[model samples]
Target: MSQPPKTQHASIPEPLAHPETRGIELIQATQRHGRARDLFPVWAAPNVSVLNFTVGASLILLGLELWQAFVVIIIGSLPWILTGIVATSGPAAGTSGSVITRAIYGIRGNRVVVAFFGWFISAVFLALNWLASSFMGAELLGQFGFTDPVLAPVLVTIVVAAVTVLVAVFGHGLILRSYPAVASVLLAIFLLVTAFVLPHAQWGYVAPEPLEGAPLWSAMTIGFAILASTPLSYTNSPDLARYLPESTKPSRIIAATALGGALPCIFFTAAGALMATGIDAVAMDLGIESALLALLPAWLGPIFVVGVIINTIALNGMTTYTASMAFQSIGVPIRRIPSAVVVGAIGTALTIYLVMSTSLLDAVNLMLQLLVLISGPTMAVFATDVILRRNRYSGAELFDEDPGSPFWYNGGWHVPGLLAVVLGAASASLFLTNPAWTGPIAAAMGLVDLSVPVSLLVTAGIYIALTRLAAKRRPGVLPAVENAAA
Candidate 1:
């Protein structure tokens, strides 16, 4: 509530109902005050979406036993390590995640990454959730004897999109405030779902017919890829964490984020696997809605539908919020609200068409596979840059458009960072496998998809080595923090 510490960046414009004047500017220290632990609920709330339950169901279908599938899921969750670590940079950088990447990739180079991983990828997520929710909304209506199938989903999408856009327009403060209530309700719903299902699960410790040779390995690889690659879609977590006080320790933040993100994911994923044990996993092709409708008690079915609908709205709020931040990072002459509106509109239209014409799960899976290629390298580049050059950000230099600014390298692009991303993406492309396309190298290499892991290693190694060499040779190619105390 109090005014923040003085900074050269322009004063933030006060909002009538919600916080405003955020996007690409340094959040002053006074504004940077919140408990690190609160992030757990906020981060955890969005993971309750239908996609997560599908992920659990997916692993079982991949030929893993119930316990084996769950274990593999735990293994896939390692990407949250970077997710939590990157969030700690929010206070120090006093900016959104995409803007902070300028410290590694330079101002112009950051735009490239933002366009692909930030805007495009975010739009993909927003659309997928929108499609799922619309169908679920229609199904819920049908249960009440409103049998106009065509009319139901179309009307539901309009309402959902409008609400999500309004919330996103309010931006960070409102989004954070809404999470606790949402998360509590979501947690209770999943707990009920889990409690009801686990007792009835007939799955054995091992699959009835175990997968053999390359089929088994490839299936396991895809399962891990799905789990690990999940975090790639959320690389902009620092955009939310930027509101936290600079004094918040990274360790505390990381622990909160990890638990918040992992717990809901594990519970729902396991529920999906359990659902598969009773009914055919293939019947769950429609994702969480199908799984829930098929699995939940008849009396509780309406509640499950409502929970999923609410979950979709909450997820879209975060997606649109982060996408707005990514839009600002693009160096465009657009404000945050307008950017969010435009993206939300396009995603809504796309979702409506896909819901009417195609399979949402198939589309989502393809997008996620592509995300593995893009997000893996993007995270690797950003994380590696932070580790190699900690405390080396110049808050002013991040917004510096001048070629001579510390963040500006080789005509406003960091060549080494760009090179690393390109190489990492190309490497990932070789091993990518999805419904629409499979990588030639992945098929050749025993059909094993090592895209995320390979991309992470290759990008991190190249970035760290090149950055160190550049720093040594140029004697200050990367910027350092202006404040010694900082």
Candidate 2:
């Protein structure tokens, strides 16, 4: 049973109701009572579609065995390489991560930091991918004696972003339609090329010694880092989930969805591992290029490079789509930029900048580190709240904006939120080796002096105690507050 609410404030406005602005209704549900009915669907096609785009391209990056990539792949990625899959039994949205922050730090448990920072990270990723794809595309043509790389990358990025934006704006059906055609052909090419190049690979370097100090752990971390986007992958799941007719088992949906996305990691890592040993890693930075040079005669390399370009485009489209969602999550409030236009334009700009900047490698590392650091405590709290607190997410109250809700911390920002976040940030800054924001996150974690798993434990414990104390005190003070309100 729910308690009668305190009087609603006259100042606050309801969420804007615009037909044009849509939610990630990727799940099938209707607005009934207080709770939204539709659980996010774990669909197969969208999952696979995203997988083909994301994992397929990721394998291509595996070709660039930069830093510890090779060591990570060889040691901990045994299962992934064998199957090329990254399954998802965990929470989808960075929701877990988001919850941790809300429960502990930020606006009395109203932590929108996940959405805020995640959008930035995803935006940067989109930019990087667009930059890489466009730059690489231009280079492919330039290598053969085309023209200027600068103009080509920039122009091409704009064009590609434009196309991607169109799809995102129109509908999901259009995006799904292209997946089979593009992913199937690319998968075939990737396989056929791998089949041919297998013989050419230098068998001697297949398994280099494990990373210098902690090979297994480092390897697993690297492998896991590659799938860093896994939790955030729920952005689109909402779209696909919306269609499952509400009766579908979300857990089953998640399993199947993860399976589709994960399958490519096996072959992709394998392809990367095999090539890392066989060819100069940099020279084979482009998988198809390596496969072409290794297996096919020299002349055919260009043709397949074109296919790689297509594959890149398909995935870039997904990147563009996700980027738009991230932007819309923020941009809608500030102004009224169309999600499509925002995604495409910003994507193009960021991509070109990152691709040209050479510092992008640093950028990527920083992004991943932040995601992990933030995700740790976040997932913990969310999981606990879902399983322990409400049984199954009975309700969520954005208490920061609307203090009348049941969960409201009732003031500006809660003390626990500020303290927990500071601690987490400090710990992350100290422990994590990556630069930029990573150091701060490690520092954040260090401030708390808890391992991610343990820090999560500590964070949850602290918050639970804090919330209970608040609840116990609330009833005693209500009469006075009510009298004051009257």
Candidate 3:
């Protein structure tokens, strides 16, 4: 492999004072800083939102008992381990996940994947989280008697979008420095929420007409898929971890990232499910925020609203940051700050449209469901590549777009990797069961959705087999197994 360029040391700036100037470029070893443990809050803060509560509530609405929902939540969280594994590539490669994927999918081929799965999906999530926060913000306003239905939502959305955009424009340094505090605040508020809601929970609550046989399994699988969507969407885990020093242990990174995300998601989502047991399912479905606010004392209502908005900013900021990076990685002409602004503007517009026209719960459910067909396979491919390559990545070579670059296989496309993603997504579609459409396999199997597992297995299997075969036939295509260690 060609040697990386000589290290160019850049002094770290005061994160609050200056915006981060780096885009999709590789971080030099000298410029790398931070510890794996720091990643905990970075991952945690985003998942600590009212949105996750809705996810739990949705599981209940899907006809599963409380225990079944808990089980599904835990199982869904397993993908965060894959997220952690993908994150290790960050420090080892010293570049954002979007950039590092150049090796797995080849330079040009990766651009398409990053543009669609990375950027587009991120933008949608940005909109979804923003919409969730705007609803809470408007409700908070209502608590103070500012309940102009139309005006309140517009004002709140604008402010929320602006704050989220500013954070994204500030970029990685600020995110690293601030997320710990954000996570702490959100956790504290939610803990209070839990304390209040726990007492009202119907622990042994059972569905009036409990589903049995194929129907029960179907509900469980669908619930698992819904909960899994959040973790699976985070292929950008490496985007935040790229600044960590190369010497950081992979195990630390894996544990920190996985636990940080899984713990809060499980807790908050379970809280949502618990809250639902006391709430009428119809009310919870119509407006989770309203239903939740009705349960809390008046004083806590505003506080909870504020917490939801803060959580939204944290979540949306992370999404915008990743989307900005994905845009740059797609060979966009604009720089990072402009890219962030563009993403924010798009998300804001989307939030307004959804608020004015669509049902929030329906949008959230459909978006999460549709995303799995792509996200599951995508994350699986990324994790599999990390293992097959043994975490060995050349940051500098990834930047080289020339045909001579080591990653420039078959005219800037690794046929096996691209083909694997296509076949995996296609296979996944066959087993997908969502409101919009039910897959053939799902229909045959009594409405059970197996897309999540099917996509992961097919994508990983194909990539591993094809990668090994290509490596055997072409010696330089992959690193020697003994020499390939991060």
Candidate 4:
């Protein structure tokens, strides 16, 4: 039972009947005038300056790297940079589970897997990040002699969630709008902070050897781990890209996104590695230590600490906010739940639990491990659907709940994509000689650590090959409306 063709209707209503056009509304008009039929008309425009993504992501990732192995994060992202290219240039046929089930598995069978893949991770990451922020806030602020540090941490979570919710509920336009400007400022402060620690960095403390074995793997893992943030950053991109003047080149968007992820990452890794060479305090251990006091005036330490906290919170906020949007996108086109409220409540809850067990350092490591495992295939699936299929989706028919629509629900399981991701993650995990995988692998013994770059490629290749084979056997399997013939 094939799905019906899409209606002529646009997802959102077209511009109201006024001769005059506003800024973005004007861009929508130009798109409607036959500029690009595929545009989805999201509120956030897709284009971002290279500086915006690089600085922001760099600050976040590097701060993380210094805590773990500075060396590992650098090595991990080496392959991730190439991987990012394969992602930003492409699009998914529909939100998660919807497109994969149709292409590989039959509509009904893969539904559970699709839903699990989509919601489980989105929910978990949102919960974890909220906790990480609140926990850090409680501990960092504890020095001020506040009574009940435990309860205070909960309030920090509330504040984080509230701010993020406000941003998300209003729509993600704020993120796209502020990324470039805010990124620049963040970068400048980051550099200033690093400069303060220049004298403290005893390069001699860094190993003369390139730090072999699992340590090497650990460093790479750190880089790969941070990839969790990439998809969240990009999930809202279609909204951003749709508004890009129809005349703007897609190549620019790809370049900017790639640069945005890569350059800052490298800078952060290098800088943090330098700091790692110098630090010693067990509590202040993650490189930004008392040395900072000697490096800068005493007053600046608190100011920088606050900045670091805010920067980290902002990055965490972005992740939490986007994760919520992704969850809502799957749940309801018009989710009644407010994003701010969700962020506040969830963030607070996560904060209390986080304080009980993990350190900021540990959470960063966990985030990378989980992110890469999911990210590799997520990007692969999206890229194959968009670039390989070309831009052809039935806006209204896709939303139809009918089982026949490839987009309605995927087959019971998308074996190709699943296998690909499995194979890819397995390869990275299997091939690695690192210490970290011991915990993840021991926990999910049969499961592959899909976060590795090796997993990403394996998954993508298998899925692509499988799709081609299916095409050869049954030419009619593809949706007539999508015309996804690359």
Candidate closest to the true structure, highest TM-score: 3
Off by over 4 Å in 2: 1-21, 24-115, 176-182, 206-240, 281-316, 319-337, 359-367, 374-402, 412-422, 435-486
Model 4 regions lying over 4 Å from their true place: 1-75, 78-115, 123-136, 147-149, 208-242, 245-248, 281-296, 331-340, 391-397, 406-415, 422-451, 479-486
- Model 2: weakest 10-residue lDDT segment is 81-90
Q: Each prediction's TM-score against the native?
A: 0.92, 0.65, 0.95, 0.70
Model 2: per-residue Cα lDDT over 1-486, one tens digit each = 221221212212113232223433222123211111112111222222212222322333433333344444333222221111111111222112223233333333343554555455556656655654565467566766777847777776777677666655544344444565665666666666566656765655423343343433433453444444334333333333322322333455444444444455444545545544554545544533233344555555555555655655555555555445543333244221366576567667777776566432344434544554554444444433433332222113221234554334455355554455446444534545443433444344332212344435555565555545554577632232223223
Model 3 is weakest, by summed lDDT over 10 consecutive residues, at 2-11
Q: How many residue pairs clash in model 3?
A: 0
Find the candidate with the highest lDDT and give its number: 3
Once fitted onto the true fold, the runs of candidate 1 whose alpha carbons sit more than 4 angstroms away are 1-16, 148-150, 205-208, 285-288, 479-486
Q: What are the per-residue Cα lDDT tens digits for candidate 1 across 142-167?
A: 88888685678888888999988887
Model 3 RMSD to the real structure? 2.3
lDDT tens per residue, model 4, 1-486: 322232333333233332111111112222322112122111111211111222223333333334344444445445433433333322222232233233433344334433555445545555555654454455456557764756766677667666655545443344544544556655666667667766666655534345455444444444544543344324333433433333334455555555555556556555655654555545244322333334566555556555444554455444444444433333334342353355446545655677566655555445545555555565555555555555443333334446555543343344555666566656555533223554355235333233445555676677678766656665555543134544
Q: Would you list the rank order by lDDT, best first?
A: 3, 1, 4, 2
